[model samples]
Target chain A: MAELSVRHLLGIKDLTREDIELIFETADHFKEVINRPIKKVPSLRDITVANIFFENSTRTRLSFELAEKRLSADVVNFSAGQSSVKKGETLLDTVNNILSMKVDMVVMRHSSVGAPHFLSRHIKANIVNAGDGTHEHPTQALLDSFSIRERLGQVEGKKVCIFGDILHSRVALSNIFALQKQGAEVMVCGPATLLPKYIGELGVKVETDVRKALQWCDVANVLRIQLERQGGDIAYFPSLREYSQEFGIDKALLDSLDKEIVVMHPGPINRGVELASDVADSEQAIILDQVQNGVAVRMAVLYLLAQKG
Target chain B: MQQQVILGKELLQVTLRRLCQEILENHGDFSNSVLIGLQPRGIYLAKRIQQILKEDLGKDIPLGELDITFHRDDFRRRGTPLRANATNVPFLVEGKKVVLVDDVLFTGRSVRAALDAMTAFGRPEKVELLALIDRCYTRELPIEADYVGKEINSMISQKVNVQWEGVDGGEEDKVWLVLSENG
Candidate 1:
């Protein structure tokens, strides 16, 4: 029998094809629960899921909350702005305090990379990394995989282009590993400065031109540019206009590619900077599908993780 | 009770090939058709069907999976439910002919629930059921497999399982028919 008991989804790199498939399968189950009149399952009836966000997040936090609630788990949201983190409590201590509340799972989003991994060691509760700094957002990657798998039928042997910010994107990093593992040829494209030098070492082809990457792939995942993470003289792109012309996915750039090619973005989208509003809102776009899949994927992650000791 | 056994591994492959041929012959154009397997055994069966169709007919079929535990009508009655397997359908199900594959068909509750679960994804052109073994009994629903391996009439207490190759790295296909009294 396939062991489905999985607790603590730390990163995409730790997941095997079986694990990925298990999540997809569980999400498929949740997909049914979601469409029900009550839209809730008693699987996690008395369990509690703590949403501890040390970093700011709207979509990720809400999605996790919805996922937990859908599984009938009691949810408690703790933001750094409202919690003991404001009173100089260390991250570990704050997490321990939350764990002391006897929550069954902790879905954490921190500004530091590997924060989830660190927390997993301290608490008995399952740890799910919502998004940590620029390290890895495992659920986002799985949802992207789910979205891609839904659109393409299978990720194996398909060409996937992940464009825009790679330097400070956990989503891009996670997708590179997840997609490649699922047998997709992953390509990363961005300004050389924004794209890491050793990214190609991850078995993904890194490109500097947007048009070329778009033409070569079946799916284009545009990443949001984190202006907050861009430091010093390296923010060389003069204006948003310049970035839009060079890196942004617009109508003309999309027109050159195959009509079957789908576009995606892990949202809170930067309207005109990394993606055009029209393209983001187009039929070829799966931005909303990404959000819908995010709930199902996170449910799968939580269900699997909670079952493991 | 006579042990209803599947003789060898080759028979399993042949069974799958026949099912694929039957599906192709009935469906004709596969452009609008998709196959979704219920998790675990069903997923494997779906993959096998996809392979047979690809090798025999040169048609690349869209294959996906569904985990039916959460959607089952008996979740509350069954205590803590088992963790669901991966559900991966990369294409839109709207207006496509969906063939639901499973290892064994018994009470038909699983297939009945699967049909209810599938409608949430999107409206499909039609959903045709396929199973390796159909233990003929009083089905909970009017659901019946469009394709079946061997139809066996069995008692409600009896267990009928269809085992395929590679289940435990064994190269033999074994069908186990066991009585509850033995346990």
Candidate 2:
């Protein structure tokens, strides 16, 4: 299983256990490369990558750019805010224009679902879905699982609970798939209005109580309250103060647990809203490790896809 | 296929002793020099050399292991993607004399990739190569070994297997030459 089974990493749903394992194994090597005095490698020198983000992003964009530069790949960045998309250019037209410049790979993040999937059917270059709306964020799921495997030795049979905003989270959906594929138990905890109705069909346990979910799991991956993505008409919770009082993880809640569970968060955290500042900066939290692992994992994804190209 | 033992355990020991003495001639006391082994197979030879040097010199010298998976030229050209081994180069290579240890010197491609990989650490003052088995007259690149254990004249179709004790649960250290009939 030296090569990945799929060419484009559209979602974790398209990946097998072996594909994820291969990516993790390759990421272990890149992790070593980044830690060295000279962090760059010339593996992708002959290839060019175009990171086309249809949505605004700071961390994912910078992480992808750093990964490309570390691999010595030529990079061209295109943002929808500044691009011709605002001038009524279609998604396909935008991508075709970038493809005309001889880009070997396209790392795209679109606000629409199935944007990368639709492009993969028509485009010639490799496609890596950075994040496609609320559909899936595959690399984020991979790095989360990798972080768990790094801290807990393995993902098999270990309990993991995803807390907060499960209704509109691509991270929650992807993590459920990735963790379940690796033989880990998953539970989603949030208000009933915030959790999707179809979450139970995905074979994950649902818990509304934060303490009960925390006590039952070995890892607690707290997600941010996506106010931007949440629709204006639907009130998922009563208020921010009420949501924090009910579901937010604080040090006192963590201290009440009989076991010391690992804490994680995919960033742009709302500080005191979902995760307390002390808990985010605590020794038990691996939020920083998740950020550092993002680059190596993205490097692994790009390097493997470049092999297929 | 035809198989033959090119170097037995006793003869391999004698050859290693001579190679160590030659290294001592060039790098006395090994104060400013380091031993770096290419990953996967080369590290076995490198570990053996380091062990013998430590026993003889009564001092532990610096040794590093470098993986060249990302530096290989045949990345997507090959049928299967290349898997990487752990690279454990803890010390900097800047301004220090370095010796790259490997079990066999083949088409000189691995050494070429190794030369490229070593630069990531730092620019070494000087560099040299040590090979336990030199498959002569088959190098595709303009590269040669600095220290050779034994030069065996063989066809490109012939395979050289250098076996070390305690590696893959093997009993003895021996080198075998297997000639494939297809070529």
Docking class of 1: incorrect
Instruction: Summarize candidate 2's per-residue lDDT along A232-306 as a digit string, tens digits.
Output: 887888889999999999999999999999999999899998999989999999999999999999999999999
Model 1 chain B lDDT-worst window of ten: B75-84
Q: What is the TM-score of each candidate against the true structure?
A: 0.69, 0.98
Model 2: per-residue Cα lDDT over B1-183, one tens digit each: 678899999999999888888999999999999999999899999988888898889998899999998998887788877778889998999999999999999999999999999999999999999999999999999999999999999998779998999999889999999987554
> What is candidate 1's lDDT per residue for A182-235, written digit by digit as tens?
999999999887888898898899889888888889999999887776556667
User: What DockQ would you assign to candidate 1?
Assistant: 0.12
Q: Name the top TM-score candidate.
A: 2
Interface RMSD of 2: 1.0
- What's model 1's lDDT at B64? 81
